[model samples]
Target: MITMSLYSEKDLDIELLEEKIIEPVNKTNESKHIVFIHGFASNSSCWELFVEKNKNHYIHLINLPGHGSKEYKPYHLIFKFIIDLIKKYIISIYQNYGPIILVGHSYGGAISATVTHELKEINENIIEKTILLAPYSKYSILKVIDKIKLFQIKNSDDFMELQKMIFVNAEKTVYELEKYLYKKLSLEFFKKNSKNLKWVILGMSLPSTFYKIDKAFKTIGSSFYFLFGEKDKLIDNQKTIQRSTINNIQPYFSIYEDKGHAFFAEDKDRFFNEIENIINL
Candidate 1:
């Protein structure tokens, strides 16, 4: 199990993320290795609540490449880079550890799904279960702009302002520790990477949706499932709503009525309850 403290202002650039992001924390000696993947522009700190709740299980919090640090090198397309990095990490973990369980939020969920899909295709028993929260696959989230501003940054100053706005906007919903961590993600990207937010976002989103998922559906157990809010603006797109039925796979999802995309942050008790139920099962 591994843990990366997202709130630390320590020099994360010194170490390659391959050597730093995975932190091993013991849930219990006999427990299945449980992994947590965070959302876009987010870090491992986002799972603080879940980590605290599942202290008895072996836990691994993954801070994806270019996140929780200031070491990003510019890349025209980083989508594949991130997936490949995670895939390598997962492979390594499986070799050192054993069968596993996965929990992910938002974009992280998509990544978890895709990674699990690949692993299962290779060896189905390696993946125990996957719990995806508000994962967006098969649709683009570029249009969720009314409450949030959507534009590219021109320079570092513009990027800082954007980060400031996000911190301000999420002031009420986000946790204090995570608020600071989010700021770091934006700043690191601006300082070390390019100003093309759209390009980065597209790179992350497109492949998650385009990847084949039939195996993902077959591999994940009913104990693990997807959680989505009917009110989530990000996934409430026209196409998402029309083909949103998961009737054939109802056992794999849980739809919340009034919650939004930030359900975990918005209601920790409810979110933790869902996670506890799955892990407990």
Candidate 2:
């Protein structure tokens, strides 16, 4: 019943989100809403494939402040600003649509999980499912050297190197998109906002931050599921699960043996099939 335009670049004056990241779409009668949150340094457009694949369902793609076309304001530096903004958006969506599914990738996954926990405290059962893809919660499994390389990108070569860390293999469209993505990342726009973006990431990775996420995953039960790539360079499936065990949490998760951190981007068809099965289940 509610949908955000998937084709618009126009800035939105709404306090929830700064701009319209997608173009307007034909309204559907479906009551189910699928909300997607993209990863760090990524925009709502990352979910364009998912949107196109589920054109018939109501969908909302959230663009975090400073990501997409959003301007980086002083308040955007705080992690709570993002978590609260998305929680407010989700509540508003539930008021219109009956219930919704929340999906987040990487950093977005951490935010989504925390927000879901906050919602649960208020006794809101509007989120039918929460799917996290290679979520960046707690300290990363990446080695110190590789992690440093990922955070500090000085050139296109560095950017491509980061891409390699994200994807299992950079063949097909992934290869083509990297050039264009690097160009954008190298622009003055990205340069200006880089500090704020990095701050947001650091804020999200705080031990206090992920403690809440772990609690959320534990309490939310099976409705909250984690899907990770066993071969992921950024997040090690075994280490992540082992950490969860240490926290006395048993997570509902799956590990794709041959995939990497951005497995969905690598093999979308198979990814969507997995998504379809999760939603159907």
Candidate 3:
């Protein structure tokens, strides 16, 4: 059986990719940890607002390889990325502290689910709680956003427009963030992570979600808590709701009626409340 204890080289194989990984460690003790993973095209800084309130726990804000840095090789399939990320951060940190509370936004939330699934796989008490903000829980065929609205993004302006379309009512701060990140977008940004595009496409062609592997939520009731915005066009809450109903999984799924794809960044009070609720649970 795989051990939950981390920082042991014998358990996880991450040495070959050490140089490529970027883990930002901040001030904290060794008892508790909160690992934050950002979504597609975004960096670890996605935890901007939540970080301020939760300064007590140790945090691992990582820049996913190929998203904001050129240090690591690009990942194509989401599963491979999740595996490596767990090996690099989750496992190692579990050794330092114990089980951690994981918070992931957007695609990061999907990645977070995969990590929880992994920790569950080993029956390892490595994840005490999980908060997924607007996560894409399953593998879906490329939707209109991925194929059209997302693929049609030609420049920075187009990217911002896409945000407006998906998030009908975003706050000024979220808009500012969109504009800022858009400015950094370039042709290379799209091509950079294309290596794993093949696997992503394959995932879309087939049934991929949690069924691709033994589901973690199956064993652990309510360990995985989900938060979705009602208007999120990119990741439909309906599918999540449907999936939840069909499977009878998890403890909570808070679908904010007024929010959209950018719910985590746009709504501060609600986002923190959901996370705080999970922490308290």
Candidate 4:
């Protein structure tokens, strides 16, 4: 088991990527350990509000390779390699801390589900529960053109335009974050990750990749919470509901009426309450 430490974001190494463990001030045996996984092109810092609100639980925040301050490598762009690294993190965490609940957003959501399902083969109870916030399972082939436009971000205006799609409100917050995102947008690693996403999105248009993506969602053996923002521009909530229903995977689907992709950030209280309710259940 890797020793838990207080390492800053920039201090992370390639071997372990980046991890931040926030142990509850009032730790108890009943205090659950919740591992958080951020979405594509995002790092663990996205869960700042989440960490602040869930002070009763031991929180594990992980930044996917190439995201956050971690050094990016060519292999890190491969989806399988990303999954393998996360799997290792989960296993190590379990070995050191026992069972955990997983909370993942967007791209991280898809990964959380996959990791949870795959790990169940070894120990069905390793992951106590998985709460997926808008898992990016299957992209609509009809929106191929729009999805293509996402990678064409050339400046801050384009990034803000993208942010507009991510949040329904929070104009001020988006504006503030724009400066940071604009800088990240110009970085080589960000460009590479964007290119990787483009290829993945285009590849999903193929029948074979589409089937695999659907199959993954269909095969989740355990019950989980599938939270979706009704107004989310990045994912089709209705299609996600349809697939979940048809598969009978037994996942609970909760749709927030006016929320967008990053609704958690938009309304941290509601998001935290939802998580609390799920964990209690």
In the range 138-184, model 1's lDDT, one tens digit per residue, is 56445344423433445555654444433323545443545446545
Q: What is the per-residue lDDT of model 4 for residues 16-112, given as tens digits with 9 covering 90 to 100?
A: 4578889887787779999999876567778877777776799988777656554454545455556667777788889888999999887788778
Pairs that collide in candidate 1 are 1-23, 1-24, 2-23, 2-24, 3-23, 27-56, 27-57, 27-58
Worst 10 residues of 2 by lDDT: 5-14
What is the RMSD of candidate 1?
8.2
Question: lDDT by residue for model 2 over 166-223, one digit each (tens)?
Answer: 7777555466555446346544435665776777666665666767767765555567
Q: What C-alpha lDDT do the candidate models reach, one value each?
A: 0.59, 0.68, 0.59, 0.72
Error of 2 at 252 (Å): 4.1
Instruction: State the lDDT at 88 in candidate 3.
Output: 59
Q: Which of 1 and 3 is ahead in lDDT?
A: 3
**What ranges in model 4 sit over 4 Å off?**
1-16, 140-145, 151-154, 170-212, 247-249
Better candidate number, 1 or 3, judged by TM-score: 3
Residue 218 displacement in candidate 4 (angstroms):
1.0
Model 3 is weakest, by summed lDDT over 10 consecutive residues, at 15-24
- Which stretches of model 1 miss by more than 4 angstroms? 1-29, 73-77, 145-171, 174-199, 205-224, 237-247
Compute each candidate's TM-score over C-alphas: 0.70, 0.80, 0.73, 0.81
lDDT of 4 at 58: 93
Q: Model 2, residue 179: displacement in angstroms?
A: 10
Displacement of residue 186 (Cα, Å) in model 1 is: 6.7
- Candidate 1 C-alpha error for residue 219, in Å: 7.7
